[model samples]
Target: MTVTRFAPSPNGPLHLGHAFSAIVAHDRAARDGGEFLLRIEDIDGVRSRDELADEFRADLAWLDLEYRDVTPQSQRIERYRSAADDLLAMGLLYPCTCTRAEVASAAVAVGPDGPLYPGTCLRRGPTPGLDVAWRLDMEQAVDLAGPLEWTDERRGAQRATPAMFGDVVLWRKDAPASYHLAATLDDAADGVTCVTRGIDLFRATHVHRLLQHLLGLPVPVWHHHAVLVEADGRKLAKRRDAPALADRRRAGEDGRSVAAELRAALFDTGISLSDIINQQT
Candidate 1:
C-alpha cells in the first residue's frame, strides 16, 4: 500500500503554491488507491498560529481534499528530542550558536537555501548551559552513512550528496526540531511510502536521505512536483505578500473549478522536474 502526506506549516495563510502541492498529493494518493494524510508542521514555536491551522482545514475542505490522519508536529516533541539525543550520543551532532546575520556574513557560498553555514560555531566547541541549536555534521554524517541513494518517482534514482547542504540543524534554537528532522521522522513514523512536495525542496532531500540512513528509518521514494510561480517569475511565498487562498474563498470563487484549473496547470507548462529544481527565481 502506498501512503503519502501533504504537510503544511501554519505560520501563514495558504496560498496558490500550497494549494497546488496539496492537490497533487491528494490526487496522487487517490489515483493509486493509497492513503493520504495531512500533517500540521507547527514546530516553529510562537510563529505558528492556531487560527491559521483552522483556516488550512477550511481551505482543504473547500477544495474537497480529504485526508485520513492529521498529525501535528507540535505534539511530537519527545520523538524529535529522542532522535536528536541518539545522534548526539553517536557524535554526529554539534551545537551551533550562529545567528542568521552572523552566518550570512561568514558564509563563503550560497546553497539552495540561503547562504551555506561556514561551520564557525562547530570550531568554537559547545557552550554549556547556553541555548544553542543542534546541527548535524554533514561531512561526518555522510562518511558514517557511507554511500547513500534514494529514488524519485518522477526523476529516477540518484546518489545522496548531503555535503551540498553543509551542517543542517536538527534541533532549532526556537523550536524543538527543525523542518528536516521533524518531517523526516514523522514520514517514517506514519509509514509514508511516497513523499510528495514542490521541487524547490529537491536539494533538501540530500540532507533528509542522510538523516534517514543515520536514524535507521524506512526510506520512501519521492515525487517532487513543479512549484507555482508568479508572473514576475518569483516563487510564491507568504512572506513575500502572496495572496491567500482564503481571499479567493471569501470572494466566493468555485473551489472545484479552481482545483481543476490547477490540475491542468501542473503539466501544461511542459517543464521537467529538473528544470524546476535548477530554475531559480
Candidate 2:
C-alpha cells in the first residue's frame, strides 16, 4: 500500500502552498487506494506553537483533507536521538560550532537552503556541553552509503549527492532535532511509501537518500510538485509574509471554494493530481 504524508511545521499558519501540497498528497493517496497521513513537524523547539498546530489541523479539515493518522515530530524526539546516536557511533557525525554569520562569511557556494555550510567544525571532536550542533560527515556518509539513487515522480531518477550541501546538521543547537534528522526518522517510522512536498525541497531529498541508506531504512518514491509562487516568482512561505489560508477563511470565503480554487490553479497549469502521480517536472 502506498502511504503518503503531508508534514507541515507548526511555526506558522497554513498558506496556499501548504494547501496545494496537502491536496496533492491527499488526492494521490485516494486515487491509489492508499493511506494519507498528516504529520505535525513541531520540533522547532519553543518556536513551535500548539495553537498553530491546532490551526493547521483545522485548516486541513476545512479543506476536507482527511488522513488516517497524525504524528508530531515533537513526540518522537527519542527516535531521532536514537538515529543520531547510531550515526555518531558509526563515526559518521561530528560536532559543529560554526555560527550562521561565520558560515556565510566562509561558505564557498550557496544552495537552496542558503549558504552551504563550510566544514569549519569537521575536525572538532564531540565535546561535553559546548552548545554545539551535530552534522553528518558528508564525505564519510556518502562513502558508507556507496552509490545510491532515489526516484521522483516529477524529476525522474536522482543520484544522491549530499556533499552538495556540505555537512548538513542532524541536530540544531536550539532544536531537539534538525529537520533533516527528524523528518527522515519520522517518515521511516510512519511507514510512508511515497514522499510528497513542494519542489523547493527537491534538493534536500539527496541528503535524505543518504540518511535512508546509512540508517538502513526503507526508501520511498518522492514527488516534488510545483510550488505556489507570487507574481514576483517568490515562493509562498511564512517568512515571506504570504497571506495565511486562515485569513481567507475568516474573510468569509468558503473553505471548500478556496481549496477548489487552489486545485484549479494547478489544473490550469496542465498538471492534475493524477499527473503528479505519473509525470516528471
Candidate 3:
C-alpha cells in the first residue's frame, strides 16, 4: 500500500505553509487508500517544546487531516544511535567538534543548505575533551555506495550527489541524531512509500538517497511541491514568525473551508483531491 508522512518539528506553532504540506501528504495517502503517518521531529533538544506537539495534532484535527500512525523522535534515540554506530563501524562516520561560526569562517564553497563545512575536523580530528558530533565521510560513503539514483514524482529520476554537501553531520553533540540520519531512518522504519514534502528540501534528498544505499534501507518515491511564500517571496518559516494557524482557529474560521482555499491556491485551480493525485501519478 502507498504510505506518506507529515513530519513536523515542534519548535513553533503550525502555520499555513505547514498546513499546505500536511494536507498534501494526507490527501496523497488518502487518494490511494493508504496510511498517512504523523511524526514529531522533536530532537532539537531544549528548543523542542513538548506542548507544541499536542498543538500540532489539534491543528491537524482542525484541518480534518487524520493520520493513522504517529512517531516521536524522542522515543527513537536508540535507533538513531545504532544507525550511527553501524556507519562508524563501516568507516563512514568521523567525530567532529566544529562550531557553526568556525565552519562559516573557514568555508570557501556553498552548497544547497548554505556555506558547506570545510572539513576542518575531518582533517584535524576531534579536539580532546570537546563534545563531538559525528559527520559522514561523504567521499568515502559515495565511493562505497557507488553511483545511485532516486525518483521524484515531479522531477523524475535524479542522480544522487551527496558530495555537494561535503561531510554532513549524522549525529550531533546536542542531539541524538542530525536530521539527515534521523528522518531517513524514520521513513524507512515507518514504511513510507512516497515522501511528500516541500521543494526547498529537494536537494537534501540526494544525501538521503546515499544514506539509504549505505544503510540498506528501502528507497521511497518523493514528491516535492512548491513551498508557500509570503508577499516578499520569502518562504514562510517559524523562525521568521509566520502567521500561526492557531490564530485562525481562535478567530472561528471554518477549518475545512480554509483547507479548500489552500488546495485551490497551491494547485492553481479548483482541482479535486483525486484530480491532483491523477495529475501527479
For each candidate, how many residue pairs have backbone atoms clashing (under 3 Å)?
A: 0, 1, 0
RMSD vs true structure, all candidates: 4.4, 4.8, 4.9
Across 159-223, the per-residue lDDT of candidate 2 in tens digits comes to: 88778888888888898888887888888999999999877788899999999989999999998
**Winner by lDDT:** 3
Q: Write the per-residue lDDT of candidate 1 for residues 1-281, one digit (tens) a residue.
A: 88889888888999878888999899888898988898999888888998888798888888888887566888999999999999999998899888999999999998777899999978999684458888888888988999999998888998998898888888888888888999999999999999998888988888899999999999999999988776656778899877788988898876776677777678624333233324321
Which residue pairs show backbone clashes in model 2? 154-281
Question: How high is the lDDT of residue 148 in model 3?
Answer: 95
The reply for model 2, stretches above 4 Å from the true place, is: 124-126, 267-281
Candidate 3 residue lDDT tens string, 55-140: 88888999998896566999999999899899999988888887888889999999987889988878887653448888899999
Q: Rank the candidates by lDDT, best first.
A: 3, 1, 2
Which consecutive 10 residues in model 1 have the weakest lDDT in total?
272-281
Error of 1 at 209 (Å): 0.5
Q: Per-residue error at 176 for model 3, in Å?
A: 1.1
- For model 1, the superposed segments whose C-alpha errors exceed 4 Å read 268-281
